[model samples]
Target: MEWSKITSDKTALSLIAIVFVIFTIEGLFYASFLGEDGIINDVDYTIAEEDAQAHWDEYKAVTVNVDNLRQALDNGNLSLKLLDEDVSIIIFESDKADGYYRGYANGVAANQAEFSFGENAFSCYVDLGTHSYQIAPSWDIVDNKMIYAVYMTDYKKEEQRHEEYPIDPLTFEISNEDNLKHNISIEVFNPSSSLIFSEEYSISPGEVIVSPDISEFLGKHRYVVVLDGDYEFEESATVARSTGLGSSEKLYFNFINNSEYPMEVGIEVA
Candidate 1:
């Protein structure tokens, strides 16, 4: 097996083929025989609008990504409808639901300001006096994340301001434009208020990020990030992780705190 003899094109082709064969065998062996489940990173899930609509029940089961819902309501009410792309998310405007309340957009606000959706699976409350037509999430566990059914109506015909950028599905990032000093604390909790994990950090200047891992835990989980020192702002997020074995994917959660300025954050899952 001299190196010089192996330099021929035929010999090189044979060596390449042998290496490919070994790799193929190794892949097959692990894929078929491995017992330890890990994260899924090998498969590509492609969604076609028409096909997705036909299988509405299956689409919502994929993951409870609220950003898609929020994005569907872009321009406050510009695209407020059942989107052709994501027909699984059902949202409609109705002055019904006897016990339900609406968020007042303007004029004389409504006296009522709370709603429980999906047969009490979730609940939400709105500030009745304010012109902001907003309702907080009830933190119901939906597909592994806290969820809220925000019933927004433009009573005063005022536009609902949209976020400047796209929401991230996994990461929480805050920009410190003024280089404000702040102490940040992040905590993870279950629906029952039981704490799962907590950590603290200090941001100097510029941008700071905290990424937490919730993939190890089973079912739905919540995360709260607070900035108590120097600045004062708090943010929270939710995640539903797949903890099954033999998976090729993993996930976690983290948070950040900013001073007086509003924090623009998104979640990202890798």
Candidate 2:
């Protein structure tokens, strides 16, 4: 072949390869934004929302079967029957100085663990690979001899398969339980750092404030709350998606002011 002809052929092949790569990258970039029903549009959002609502309804309709009449153990694996499954359990030792519990599930160390209090009662957090649960006793036990009324406050199955859809209209419910009025500032942003909603409210004692429905904006976003007062607040927020409908799936940031000091709390909601 002639030298010029060979060079021209190489140049043409290079141009075709560049075009192919550009189109492939563009296709993938758009594919990342596609919704569950293929195209990303208002109709897709409505269909996904309706399907999610149906799942929530079915989950709510199911009867919860809990066996709380089991005996408490001081330490070691405690097996309990829940929903017809032999779920392995581990009780947090109260004597730990750090207030952190470490234990094994199915012969493997738990991935995550924590402890919290509600109404002055103890709550346990355990993550066992595909399953995570928040368990608590019904009543305080004097010793390990008491029959602990254990119940699951939260349960998540990581192995369960499901279609991905963004749950829209994240509602923010703020309440001032203290005797004094509180000026609370609330803000929500999208993934692109754009301010989608922002509002400040003066909430009085025994008063509650609810934010407007947040539509369109989806994916992991930032939620922030600032209380304009010197008060010690406890953040009781859960980012977990609920199996119930409406406000049940909303990310709740409960601020319990017990002291006179200003504080701000921010969390990411998905």
Candidate 3:
């Protein structure tokens, strides 16, 4: 009886030992196959996330560049005339938002301080949408005026007649009957900000004088005519200065003869 009991007890112990081994193996298998490796498997997943982040950053950069380019095109192609006291730019992005953008001439002052426009006349605007920023650029002139042909030339002291000059005379006149004056000065400039010529002269009222010496000023150059009086019909004068990509070096007629008599005129190339 004792021997049988010992045998049974040993057998039971052996069975328990086998079951424990099997459970240990199963636990290891579950940890390796299901728990550790199953959650995130691909070796390249981290790299993929990095690549996706790079691509997203590039897309954002491109979006910003496109926005800036759009603004530049709008400012370049469309010339805004500030006849009204103020003009506003819509900043709601779509009409659904409540924000507003504002713009005005704001009267030009000599800039002694930062954020000030320096001795410059600019058309200014504000963006109230994403940014509380200001947009200011050199102003331009557009108004009602007749077109006249003025001649420009370089005169050689040796040659008395217009036929002697080598360069072809530039003979386009700006017509402004109201800006009648006793004295007139004509200027021509090149894209390089070089002054081609600055000449002073006098003309009779209601007279269209073709410069006897016109051959010198005609070339691939922009011309400016400064007369000494106000326009006949309008109290203000219009000036179109500088022809370039952004009108960066542009100026407009700011001189109104507040003086009782006429003013002397000079030309500058910038």
Candidate 4:
């Protein structure tokens, strides 16, 4: 072969190799940002983080006082009150059952203290005389808004109210109308905020499942129920004693899987 031709061929091959490496690197960089659906994964994640922060900031800006708290309580909202000074409130994420301490919001003075909380669970502790009493209250987040309240309530040392109240048997009926199997979790907490019962079940399509008579063993009139699954329900419920002449009421939940890809779950409560 001619010397010049040989050199030219080598140069062309080097150029081709360089171009191939450049294209390979570019393809990998593109794949790293884009998901299988051609959507930018990193951008989506950043957007989600921004939205969550916005919600957190909005919640932190809320301040609860005496009047609104009473209105909320009258509207059947759950709350924990700090009637005196030097009371401390601890907030935790709903999914955490191990008492993961997130942060503290203390109540200074009386009902004039400013209070704010994120869309999480709340536990308040007050030192009454020499005894320190603690209560964890149930809260709910509905329509991207927190539907709970906190305020102050007067308490006397003579109350010494730590006993559990007697309640009727409360039953939960869940029916899966979806074509897919779902894993369900039920957690029941007593008035003292103790997790008395926790159970998990897998329900098949078109299956109806009834929880064991929870009050039969627990026997607490007022309880907090936290439900979780591949679908959605009330998520958290504070069940109070029924005022009717009959026994405590039963809760019915219907779950349906409406979407195939994203697993859209529709819950109907009757």
- Candidate 2 stretches greater than 4 Å from native: 1-77, 89-100, 110-115, 136-162, 167-270
Listed per candidate, the RMSD to the true structure in angstroms reads: 21.5, 24.9, 38.9, 22.9
Model 3 stretches with alpha carbons more than 4 Å out: 1-168, 173-181, 212-219, 229-270
The residue ranges of model 4 lying beyond 4 angstroms of the native Cα positions read: 1-166, 178-180, 188-196, 215-234, 245-249, 256-270
Residue 264, model 1: Cα distance from true site in angstroms: 2.3
lDDT digits (tens) for residues 63-181 of candidate 3: 01123323533342212212111322322221113211222212222211111111222112322222122222212111221111111112232133324322333343322233445
The TM-score of predicted model 1 comes to 0.28
* lDDT, candidate 4, 95-131, per-residue tens: 2334323323343232221222223443434443333
After TM-score superposition, the amount by which residue 202's alpha carbon in candidate 2 deviates from its true location, in angstroms, is 11
Using alpha carbons, what is the TM-score of model 2? 0.31
Worst lDDT run of 10 residues, candidate 3, spans 54-63
Best by lDDT: 2
When 3 and 4 are scored with TM-score, the better candidate is 4
TM-scores of all predicted structures: 0.28, 0.31, 0.21, 0.34
CA lDDT, every model vs. true structure: 0.31, 0.37, 0.26, 0.35
Give a tens-digit lDDT track for model 1, residues 163-239.
22211233344444444555667665533234567777766666545455333322234555454432322233333
lDDT of predicted model 1: 0.31
Q: After superposition, how far is residue 49 of candidate 3 from its true place, in Å?
A: 45
Give the candidates in order of TM-score, highest first: 4, 2, 1, 3
